[model samples]
Target chain A: MTANPKGGRYRAWGLIVPTGVLYAVTFGIPMAMLLSASFARFEAGRTTPGFFLDNYTRIASDGVTLQVFWNTVTLSAQITAVGLVVAFPVAMLMRRAGPGMRLALMFVLVSPLLTSIIVRNVAWMLILGRSGLINTWLMDWGLISSPLALMYNRLGVIIAVVHVYLPFAVLPIYAALRAIDPARENAAASLGAPPWRVFVHITLPLAMPGVVAAFTLLFILSMGVYLTPVILGGNFVVTLPMMITDVARNQYNWPFASAMSVLLLASIVVVVALASALNRAFSPPRND
Target chain B: MTERSGSPFGYAMLAIFGALVAAFLLLPLVILCIQSFTAESFLSFPPPSYGTRWYRHVAAAANWREAALSSLVIAAIVTPLSLVLGTLAALGLDRGPMRGRGVLYGILISPMILPHIVLGLGIFRIALDLHIDDSLLSIVPAHLTITVPFVVISVGASLQSFDTGLEKAAQSLGASPLRALWHITLPIIRPGLVGGGIFAFIMSFDEFIITYFLSVQTRTLPLEIFSTLRYQVSPAIAAVSALTIAFSAALTVALMMRGQVISAGRIVR
Candidate 1:
């Protein structure tokens, strides 16, 4: 520690300045503009610079947008729930897997993340569309006379989204599971505690942090989903982001779009805060 | 890694469920790859016949080639720029003043969690006001907003396990501070750098939302794919998806071979 050069601390701090400048220019200023634009007046598709509450008022009174926002929230919760249920077993199996098996599992989970979202969704279209593989095979086998309404609806959107986001949920829970001390579980087992009881009492509580993390992340990521609902939802399921894009791009109503963005950001922050608070309330006291 | 000493029935059920989830993860991609080789012009699964015609179509298509090229160029540029910025930020947060380290770390990593739509709209508004909406000048910076966070995170993780003593020993042995860092520190953290760089390239290359707002005439690969999918479901998209999947598969192998650079524990940390 005594090998420090003169003013090393100053120079060390200086290293961050470049990125700081870049973030300030790229994110900070634009965010300020977004906030300001949210309050600006918009009349007849023309965004004029001024303070106004019409945009917020419209969102509050416009029953359709609220419904869409609620739909987005519900969709996010459903996706998170499905993701957690599917991912937990995979994570457990991963923990029990050999090194080679673990690497292969990681490959399966992470490769989907590396591919573009549209590409993944395109794959889903081929699988889940009304005339997709499932429907085609079912019809061919005479299992059903008609193609199931598998896609072009909310179910399709949820399926495709879950496929894409499942890894995001899995990775954290797996990490959490891996971090658990093996001795505790062994001790519980040695005490004649049943396997199910050991899991529910010992392992599950320890992994709550990871579960909470996964939930928060999946929910946030899901809330911002725009492309999936558009491509997979067949435009039938309108989410908040889709509505914002429509308002901004097609309607040329920047103020209104900004207002919606504000709403989306606010909701995300609120939900994340609530999740952390609930975790705090329910989590057993940490030994650390 | 605790072995879950579950009941036989429970173990059997868990393994079955796990295998099914794995298959579900791979099924769409396998189907899409199969569809890419169809002999027919239209999109169909378990194709009546197989051919490489769609692949050849994508190869010969001018717009597809241009879009792919543009995406590569942007990724190539954004990769190094974000790498340097992110590495510097990580180095600073690791070795610099400790007064606001937690706050700084959170700020640097926040972009990764922020919804892309809000960022896209914000940048789009800025580009419009500055009249630079349809150019690389606007798009590159927008891409950086998201990509830099990945570098900071991955590189920071590497730094967390780094041995500061090596750099100190070098300094004590008469190497300058900067030289010690350059020789002793950077080489050991190369895995993190490589991992972060790969993430940066992929993120920038696959980035669609911000670029969707910023570009009109200059279409990246994802933008091209989006527009193509919007118009009609074509076998050509299957070809493109297959190619991207192949590329990702290759990257995944490369990352795994690098020995846990993208490990779940490191990422969650």
Candidate 2:
């Protein structure tokens, strides 16, 4: 049955109208314009509207673009993988802790998220710099006579990116683990299954949805990461966002930059779709 | 679940994981705080001497002050506007029997999932075409696109759990629709609205990409910090970072506290 008796549907329509107009003007039109701009040419302080495929062709053939594509994919995957491994057990521990301890841990875990990305990257720059804490501590302990190059490298970029995005991984996994009844694990244990076996066969599978969600979230975030790589990678590594920035803002090549952004968007959508499909395929069968 | 009194390995593993995660999260913020006290003019770690010179410098720098002010002003404007608009949208969508509601909601929330860099570029091009480029007005609309979805989700969740029967009862008691909404419905959802608005404010304040693109004449705090990092690494930036961190952390704590109070009230009821 319908909730409203009168033909007062116009009241709801009235409320939606303002928001719809704003969304259309701000989001919808621009997104469509961006798609069209990817195919047009911009030169000599003028944009020539046309159906040109040259921008996409350049992206396909360019070595830098290919490297950026691969780098973006691999880096996103690596961060998602590493973050899950680190976050899962921590979330489990958080689940079992007392209320005070859980709150304290949550605070600590989410503290990094509160800071600006620029600040977080700078902090990493200090810690991972040549004469930074890690190198200094290593030298004092006689682990190495020379300071290792930690900052402005791929390893450093991954470390910093993971640091910033870890909360995204932790929070979802923590929520999922909390939802799983502890009694299920106890039941498995009472049925003579070992702890490791129970975790592997039951708990891990149940938490797969969380894993998928975290992976998708982290992967998407990592793909668009600009500041971390710009700060930590120095002139060494370049991601798609950095490339897009250089092309669009620095060089004023709107068409080429639009093309690259469109490619990045398409790739992100494809990855997310694949993830959803995989999650559905592996999801536990429902008992009716 | 009783605490297990066995397995030293379990306790050791827990301790190690907790310590590592804490270190990973806190190290950067702590290091940034420490570096702000460095005596040198450059970004030299393990400074020979410690002082608050950078804090003084940050206090005096006009550009830094201007950027911080612009960020505050923009966030102040964007937060409340987005909240009202978002709440209206959520209420309408939740109450209505609109066709393709799921699809419409997905479309509405799509902005959150779209990359900021792309949005930044789109807005950059749009503003240029519209001749509104490099203005504070431009930044507000861009911030709204990101903030509105958050308000919709949070407020919509609250609305879903609310009892509409109360509204009907109020109507039977001769209360007008507007009056019922004002006196009854709005109070019940106030917590969610506040929480969501705070979330939106924090997101806009910490936003970097959109501001970096859309802003040319005006710089937000994040844009200023980004520019400084490119030319010179200094302790003043760290001080700014520390300030932003403290502000956001306070807001987060307040939101979480409000959440606890609301849930506790639910339990009592």
In model 1, which residue pairs have backbone atoms overlapping below 3 Å? none
TM-score of 2: 0.92
Taking the tens digit of each residue's C-alpha lDDT, what string does model 1 give over B1-269?
25556676876787788789889989788888988999997888678899999889999999999999999999999999999999999998888767788999999988887899999999898889899999888888889888898889888888999989999899889999779989999999888888888888889999988898888899899999999885357999899889988998888778878875345235533
Error of 1 at A134 (Å): 0.7
lDDT of 1 by residue, A1-288 (tens): 233544676468677888888888778898888889999999876778889998899998989889999999999999999989888899888887778777778877877777788898888888877778898899999999999987778899999999988988888888888888788888899899988899999988988888888888889999998888889988788999999999988898998999999999999999889889968965866656
Tell me the deviation in Å of residue A5 in model 1: 6.7
Candidate 2 C-alpha lDDT tens digits along A1-288: 125544565357467676787778778888898899899977776778899997888888977798888988988888888988988888777777778878778767655665678878878877888877788889989999999989788889989999988877877777777767666777777778876787787778877777787888888889988888888999888889999988888888898888999999998899799889979976864523
Report the TM-score of chain B alone for all candidates: 0.94, 0.87
Best by DockQ: 1
TM-scores of the candidates in the order shown? 0.96, 0.92
| lDDT leader | 1
